[model samples]
Target: MTTAVDTRQVRDLAVAALAWVSAHRGDFALGADALTADGPVDLTWKPLGELAQTCVSVRRCTPPSDPLHACASDLLDFAWQQTGRGELFLRLQRTEPFATYPLEVYSVFAGAGLRHTGYEVAAGAVARSRGWRLTEHEPTRRLGLLNAERRSGIHRPERFAQALGRTWLGGLPEPWTFERTSGYALTHVVFHLTDWGRTAQDVPAELAAYLTDWLPPWLDTCLDAGMWDLACELLIVAASLPQPIDAATLQDPWRRIARVQHASGALPLMASDPARTHEADPEPSFVHGYHSTLMLAFAAALTQGVPV
Candidate 1:
């Protein structure tokens, strides 16, 4: 049976995590050389992508009344100013393996930022052309292309609908076996299906049912193994379902993660031995904690329906 989630506790944790991110924003910022008269540009795309997503997550999870709301908004503005105009700039210098990730990240962040904050940054004709070229040249990136379309309000419904018809949620490998790739792919699929949960009907009934049934066990397995990042992503999937998972089902993982969060507000990549921190960086590295903390904030925001 499901029980009640301690919402106050969840809010406190999110606020703390947001505070930690606010304090460390510079650590996540692009180098000084990346800034330009037009705005910040020439960013290191990967970290900027991560930071963008982090800003979106926090923004989605906090409310105007909440103190973190202003901070999230500021950080997002900072991120957009730094990288928004640079979409085409980064594309020009793109390298393999990292190529598609930055585009997808920028699209997700830009789209969600617009949705939540009414903040607009034009990707321009060059970026649009780049998206089409990437889509045509990289057939596997159909989802990313759709995301870019949806965010930019380009309205290619037929293409998105066609892609949805072919999606096979059950065909995905179990989280335990495929680990990182499988987990990330599933999260992306859900994000697209729900349009980041803006349209509940967009989530197909079959996919929603599959997640409703499987997510609990999958979440437990990841938590048991101390895969905090995957566990957090699973929580996001659970939050996005049409029939939302019971908050009680998420309570244990939430509390465990909260417990493991360092006083600095950064969560370790896994449940770590205290002795290990002494040997490495004194604080949990931002890279180590970013996704999990960001997702935790997202889960709290989505589950609670904090006003965008």
Candidate 2:
């Protein structure tokens, strides 16, 4: 007999998580080598993109009166500035014209009404080439490129549905086959399909039905394993469906997550992890913690209703 999740608790969790992210914004800054092809993109660009993307969801969902709205807006502004007002993206585009990452990162800002005409013109020219259209990517990667193109207003010949069909989730694979990597892949599949939950209706009926059937057990598995990041992502998937799972069904996971969340709103990568080192080893903490925290905020925002 589960109870409904407290709306106030959800809001409070989001507030605290955003507070943590805000305090650690500096950790997301790019290193001097960030522009080089061999730079540690996972640490620098990836986290910043995730931060900006989650902030976009927060601002989109929360009302101006909500504290989250202001906090997320500030963070989004900071993230944009970190990219040197989109100049970094332009530079990356020039150096790695065929790379999909910069375009994908830029698309998040683009969707939020941030634009860099110079980047777009250059990206557009490259994207229109036969090589760009013909390049092969993994199913999930292909979906990402397609979504980035859609968000950035870059026309591509590929259809989203066609690309989606090639994905693991699109195949509607056996539910028992779910694993760590597949879990992330499927969540991303949903993320792309629904535009990070902004357009839940975009989820095809069959895929939504598949998620509705399997997501509860998957959520339980992640939480039971103390995989906070994956659990939060599953929650986002749950909320992104056309008809979201019941709040009651989510009570236990929410309670477990709340218990582990620090007073400052940061969460560990997994259960009973090391004591946080804000000074000595902030990178590990920031890289692992930010995604889960941002996911929590995004899930909460979706539950609060983003007005479509």
Q: Please tell me which predicted candidate would have the highest lDDT against the true structure.
A: 2
Per residue, candidate 2 scores C-alpha lDDT tens digits across 93-210 of 8788898899999999999999999999999999999989888899999998889988999987789889988999999999999998999999999999989989999999999999
Please, what are the lDDT tens digits per residue for candidate 1 over residues 31-131?
64443333333335555666666567556655677666777777777766665454543533332222334446556565664332221223333344545
Q: What is the TM-score of each candidate against the true structure?
A: 0.75, 0.93
Alpha-carbon shift of residue 62 in model 2 (angstroms): 0.3
Q: Compute the lDDT for candidate 1.
A: 0.60
The per-model lDDT (C-alpha) reads 0.60, 0.85
Best TM-score among the predictions, by candidate number: 2
Off by over 4 Å in 2: 1-3, 272-284, 306-308
Candidate 2 Cα deviation (angstroms), residue 41? 0.6
